[model samples]
Target: MTEKEKMLSGEYYDPGDAELVALRLKARLLTETLNQTSVSDADKRVNIVKSLFGSTGRSIHIESSFNCDYGVNIHVGENFYANFGCVILDVAEVRIGDNCLIAPQVGIYTATHPLDPIKRNSGVEYGKPVTIGHNCWIGGHATINPGVTLGNNVVVASGAVVTKSFGDNVVIGGNPARVIKEIACSDC
Candidate 1:
C-alpha cells in the first residue's frame, strides 16, 4: 500500500516519504500566503485559505500565527473560527464540523511516534484522524489528540488535554479530558 493509504489505515509509515514532502511544501507556501501583509482583501484571504486547506465553508476565520503540517488534510465546516496561535499537525485527516469555535493556542494533532526507542529512531511514525462534531467549543490551550471524535454540542474547557472520544451534549475538562456534566439545550 502507499504511504498515505497506510496512514489512513492506521498503520505506521515513514514520515519522510514523498507524499509527506509534497504536503510540507504545499503547507509552507500556503503559510506564506496567509502571513502576507499586502493582502488586505478578505476575499483574497478566504481564497488563499481555501486553496491551502482541503475544504472550508463560508464565514470561516483563522487568526494569524496559525500553523499546520499538512493543510490539505485539514477540513473545516461552515462558520468556523480558530483563534490565534492555533496549530494543527494534521499528518492524518482532521475534520472540524460546522459552527465550531476553537480558542487560541489550541492544538489538534494527529501525528504520533513509536514509544520504543529503536522504532522511534528509525523515523517511522503513525497518524490517526481527528473529528470534531458540529457546534463544539474547544477552549484555549486545549490539545486534541489523534483518533478522537468529539460529538456535537460538546464544550471543552480551557487547558484540557482531550485524549478520548466524547458523546454529544457534554462538558469536558482537565487533562485527558473527562466529562464533567451533560449540557441541556435550554442552557443555550
Candidate 2:
C-alpha cells in the first residue's frame, strides 16, 4: 500500500514519503494563505477553509492562524467555531461534530510515535483518528492526544491533556484528564 494509504489505515508509515510531503506542503500553503488573509475578509476565509477540509458543514467559523497537517483528513460539522491558534495535526482523521466550540491554542493531534527507540529513531510514525462529539467545548491550550473520542456535551477545561475516551455529558480536566463532573443539561 502507499504511504498515505497506510497512514489512513492506522498503520505505521514513513512521514518523509514524497507523496505525503507533497500533501503537507499543499495544506501548508493553503493554511498560510488563509492565515494571511485580512480578518475582515470573511467570505474569502470561508472559501479557503472549505477548500482545505475534506468536509465541512455550513456555519463553521475558524479564527486566524489555523493549521493542519493533512486538510483532507479533517472533517467538521455545522456551527463549529475554533478560536485563534487552533492546530490540528491530522495525520489520520480528525472529526468534530456540530456545535463544538474550541478555544484558542488548542491542539488536536492524531500523530503518534512508537515507544520503541529503534522504531522511533527510524522516522516511522502512525496515527489514529480523533473524534469529538456534538455540543462539546474544549478550553484554551487543551491538548487532545491520538485515538481519543469525546462523547456529546463534553467539556474539557483549559490546559487539559486528554489521553483517553469519555462518554457523553461529562466535564473533564487536568493533565491526563479525568471526569470532573457530569453536565446537567435541561434540554438534553
Candidate 3:
C-alpha cells in the first residue's frame, strides 16, 4: 500500500513521502489564507474553510489560527463553532458531530508515533481516528488524543488531556481525563 493508504489504515508509514508532503502543503496554504482574513470578511473565511475540509455542515464557524494536517480527512457536522487557535492534526479521520463547541487552543490529534526507539528513529508514524459525538463541548487547551471516541453530550473541562473514550453526558477532566460528573440530559 501507499504511504497515505498505510497512514489512513493506522499503519506505520513515512510522513515525508511526496504525496503526504503535498497534501500537507495544500492544507497549510488553505489554512494560511483562512488565518489571514479579518472578521469583516466572514464570507471569504467560511468559503475557504468549507473548501478545505472533506465535508462541513452549512452552519460552521471557526476562529483565527485554525490549522490542520490533511484537511481532507477532517469532517464536521452542523452548528459547529470552534474558538481561536484550534489545531487538528488529522493524519487519519477526525469527525466532529453536530452542535459541538470547541474552546480556544483545543487540539484534536489523530497522529501518533511509535513508542519503540528503533521504530521511532526510522521516522515511521501511524494514525487513528477521532470521533466526537453530537452536543459535545471541549474546553480551552483541552487535547483529544488519537483513537478516542467520545459519546454524545460530553463536556471536557479546561486543560484536560483526554487519552481515552467516554460514554454520553459525562463531564471529564484531569491529565488522563476521567469522568468528573454525569450531566442530566432531559432532552436526549
State the lDDT at 107 in candidate 1. 95
Q: For candidate 1, write residues 2-77 as lDDT tens digits.
A: 8878876779987789987887888988877886734457677787788889999988888777889978889999
Give each model a TM-score. Answer: 0.94, 0.99, 0.99
Q: List the residue pairs that clash in candidate 1.
A: none
Candidate 3 C-alpha error for residue 42, in Å? 0.9
Q: Model 1 reaches what TM-score against the true structure?
A: 0.94
lDDT by residue for model 3 over 124-153, one digit each (tens)?
999999999999999999999999999999
Q: Please, what is the whole-model Cα lDDT of each candidate in the order they appear?
A: 0.89, 0.96, 0.96
Residue clash pairs of candidate 3: none
Q: Candidate 3: minimum summed lDDT over ten consecutive residues — where?
A: 37-46
